[model samples]
Target: MRRFVYCKVVLTTSLVWVLVDVFLLLYFSECNKCDDRKDRSLLPALRAVMSRTHEGPGEMGKAVIIPKEDQEKMKELFKINQFNLMASDMIALNRSLPDVRLDGCKTKVYPDDLPNTSIVIVFHNEAWSTLLRTVHSVINRSPRHLLVEILLVDDASERGRGNFMKLRGAAASRGQVITFLDAHCECTVGWLEPLLARIKEDRKAVVCPIIDVISDETFEYMAGSDMTYGGFNWKLNFRWYPVPQREMDRRKGDRTLPVRTPTMAGGLFSIDRSYFEEIGTYDPGMDIWGGENLEMSFRIWQCGGSLEIVTCSHVGHVFRKATPYSFPGGTGQVINKNNRRLAEVWMDEFKDFFYIISPGVVRVDYGDVSARKALREALQCKPFSWYLENIYPDSQIPRRYYSLGEIRNVETNQCVDNMGRKENEKVGFFNCHGMGGNQVFSYTADKEIRTDDLCLDVSRLNGPVVMLKCHHMKGNQMFEYDAERLTLLHVNSNQCLDMPSEEDKMVPTLRDCNGSRSQQWLLRNMTLSM
Candidate 1:
């Protein structure tokens, strides 16, 4: 009994000392802050940015007159880390951002039974100010009852075993829900409630906030459009697309309703812990960050789970041009390797389309996918085809084209170009050589000649051949190919692709199909040849 008493006393004394130490530390911190205030009357922007004492400061449409020294500082920082780190440092940690929420969203209320979330942040060589600013944003803005813990995954800023896995394991004991965010992001006032509310309704729901852009050039918290959702092309690169009418209709006249997404843009999202593990977390094999976003989206959708973008919840992220950290064996190699793994495991027979679009990826050794394949089977996940059919109905599935090369007039030897044409400002034919560059084009099974996202457009009959953004909606963007007749026909305009034989006619114009040699084209395949 006496020994237990002694141990209790010792523990009490230790606790007392810890409390005293904390007290003293906080006191000193306050003293230091007071000293700082005395040193310099607070920065003018602080009143303007933090407390709305002076509003409309960051919204400087024109260049704010920055000092020469500040400009030099920004330039130096850009060299260090492709983003304006200097400007980020200048911005207050608790800078007030304009409430970009729609009027319909403000009255939305979440249930009291919403599960608490532990926001997990991972970083490598991130700016100290920005990282802490993110943490503070969550702390300040989030409801205390809803936020469980904030997990930080450190990749060691160098080669390490698995820092993300380690952080995930650590956070497991703390919270039921987990959110992964980049180190350099800022959250708005009501960003947490909507995400938590949605996940509560469906534990399998992987929800994301509408990502707002924190400008890399200037440290502006730029508002993002709510009318967009995450999407991807055949290459597995994430792109924003306008929210479809089908999705908008489900909202039932409410603008604040969550959007069902085809894929995630990556970077920021929240997930239920149990559901994440059941879905088999991340493919521990993925190195760094590239194709993991699409892989996870495919996994979630194919495995009886749904991914949604909670329009009401919003967060700001720094969109940097180039990553600051170093990657072993080059970033391109890692990304290609990762993509190859995804294609092999998830894409099945359709994986060849990815190789068709990006031939370099075919050569990459994506390591062993036996384990991932087994995992997919073990989960009894639906095939990727199902995901393509139901979840992403609008996605254009590319098949091997009968001809994949430059669309060139055999007579003039000039390739069809999308430039020197005003319709797209990127439409025209340059000098034709066997060498195909932007001239390189491919005809898809859907009857469209496309290079990346541009589709050959026939806006009007007898108009110049132009290239417009590919919507894949079978409107003016779609064209019908008659391989047997050797006539390229426009479905809507009901005109044939013709190179006018008239002298000084530089453009490829639409006209009646006369079976003329000027209209006939050759497809030289090797290396997208003309």
Candidate 2:
């Protein structure tokens, strides 16, 4: 009886062990299936978990309307970041943004073997909500396998500037590519693939997404124009101009194709890790954030690499009217110092134009740029003339110009001023200040008297000398300055740019050419390079 009982116990124990093994096997198999699903559709899983559809503040990229009671509070807090921090706090961290891409972009297919990237975001005392939202949006929208890591570089200085933070992040980054993004930005769907794909295809290509605007007041997502590409004024401030017809024809009107840009907005872009290093990354000598975008843009184009804006990719950034942060040496001083370094290194002879436009920059001691100059020499980069003629043919900086400086009337001793005006505004004369800004003008090789992007134009006889957008066609914009006669003859109007008449004390007029003192003008500091 004892032997039979022992055998029965052994059999029952064996059966129990078998059942436990089968249960464990089934559980692990289900877990493996889940892992597969996550690997395949990680972005969708994130969207399901983090994205919300119910109507709320900042939902679907709609503007968040502040209540009447909160207007005063909102205004008070807006000064902190030059943005509506209160509205940002109210919005969900994972707020949904609209897919602001063209239909053709949506249908496009990128290579499956695109390289992974490490996003480097540099911030100094950035708002809590906007900073975190930038992170969450990236994770929720980008594919998991494609985004290796997100590096938050906080180079907050007591002086309220960021210095060499990006270099530090690049050194620590482990991904195949490094993408730099602003602290207050939102990544949209499929933003990663196109950027990475372009870098994979040509490692030398530095690509930027079309940056959309997030309203500073109400936190509304507004689509930026894809037709616009980056350019810079004479002050080296980045500006957007329409994509030239030459580029449109080159791409055969395919808006989805990458547009060759002269410069980038500097906040968001992607570059291959090895290629970035090979191209000699950001200039270490550059202080804080100012002309780094143009510096890199010139470096890329001049050093046999191409800079482009991938239209298929879109990211949203808060466009602030002014910076809330402080500069150690004041904003103008810091920016001037930074820009002077770029001009000294990259602009070559073109540096004269910058100095001629911003005469004050000559006094600011730009630190040593020998290393940067050495880098340029080592790269065997093309000259600035090549860049202007080939890469940015339509650049506002005239390649060949007869004169660049103040246009002063001999009699009134007043200078022809842009008056800080926009297109079609009547051009006025102000007391010659000798300081450049509103008084500066360039007599270009194209025979247009240009200031920034506008030219002195007069279409009809005795028409007010107005500042019009410089049309290269030069119908009414053409002017011939007779150095012997000291008169500027209008080509189309058959008149000269006369000084402000007794009747019109502020506005300059176009009258029939006479060698009168009012019509007599001097191109101060004129260089006969033309």
Candidate 3:
């Protein structure tokens, strides 16, 4: 009886162990299948054709040709949507985007405790299909638990509900953070997580997604490769430039980390609701659209908050040349007035440079800046100079320098002037004036000789030495001032300046660096003008 009992117990135990192994195998197999779907859905570069030639006269491989009869409708739609709305609808947008992130970006795991977000999409005159698609895309893609609400602020759009754009404000929202976006854009998968995660790390950190471009014509989603930081010219116009060497070096070649920008493109970004309100939201005096981006960036950086662009999140925007909406005042007038307020409130002594660049604004009424100025003092924000020095040292205008004057030939004593000169135009010496007029130049620590939006450059082999728009990178725009030789040597070509013959219309040529007197240039007098 004991032997029989032992055998029976062994058989029962063996059967139980086999059942557990079978169950584990089935569970893991199902998990792997789910992972496969996610892997395919995450890579936009590998999905679909990605190359769509649906608009105008063009063809991509296996193009989904738009019928000739549909061309006029497309033109009308483009005019309305400021994007290829027709194509956006036709393309299989129920898809993924190429993971436009650095290798390191994928390594991060967003915290589960991220704050709820409300997406605010403002539209003036937009297409219904694209607008609805945007709403649906967010609803479908975003985690339902994390998204508090989606607010559609229509600025009197006549397209969908006819009068939706005129709606003043959205209904009540429940989100801790609010994201502002244009109506004509598509959000990629895993977009909201990264943005919300960063805000969770620091509530005062205003963050932006890596903005990708959706072609206005082709409607193909284009990935933005160069992760350049946003900056502005002296005119407060926004521009994207390569990462400064110093800033990049701090990363140690890690592209996944968030990049600090002096300014942002302004339109599409996420901010803490309280921080936005606390830091004084868009200047109420400002017009419908213009200079608001720079204004907000300045306010945030100054008022104990920070702004950054998160590389992991991606959103494709339709960059249109002409906005569909109309400004009550002329667009230029509104922009000038808005910028005038920006200068008054934050620019400090550097505001004088505004008058020098656009003297008309000095006369035009910028409205009362007393309230904005008072707000700045109340916040006890850092001065614009501190922001410039600490945040953006690569800037050209009003930066650090020992000399600010004209590059003059010792023999002729003529100022190097390139005003109104086109590419390859010969740079000639004009009389030096103390006013630091257009001919006046500034020699920066980076060895760039610049003035009036132009930099000293040389074209192809032995080409005319001319003034070109500053590229702010290593190229013709970069020059080496050999103080020992007293000559301007082109960094890339290793060629020194040479004026073979002394004539009024003579174009300087680049020749071997033999250190000739014609090539020698000296800073006659340092003029303190930018």
Task: Using TM-score, give the best candidate's number.
Answer: 2
Total clashes in model 1, counting residue pairs 3 or more apart in sequence or in different chains:
7
Sorted by lDDT, highest first, which candidate order results?
Answer: 2, 1, 3
lDDT of 2 at 225: 82
| TM-scores, one per candidate | 0.80, 0.88, 0.71
- Return whichever of 1 and 3 wins on TM-score: 1
Model 3: colliding residue pairs: 44-97, 44-98, 154-165, 155-165, 156-165, 156-166, 157-165
RMSD of each: 8.2, 13.1, 16.3
Question: How big is the positional error of residue 107 in model 2, measured in Å on the Cα after superposition?
Answer: 1.4
lDDT of 3 by residue, 27-139 (tens): 33434334655533423421232233334221221123467999899888777656666666565433344555566666788888889888877655456445544655576
lDDT of 1 at 479: 62
Highest lDDT: give the candidate number.
2
Model 1 lDDT tens row, 466-508: 7777776777766666656656777788777777546436667
Q: Show where candidate 3 strays beyond 4 Å.
A: 1-65, 92-98, 157-172, 401-447, 452-454, 458-463, 468-530
lDDT of each: 0.71, 0.83, 0.67
> So what's the TM-score on candidate 1?
0.80
**Cα-based RMSD of candidate 2:** 13.1
Query: What lDDT tens digits, residue by residue, belong to model 2 across residues 202-258?
Result: 999999999999999999999888899999998899999999999999999999989
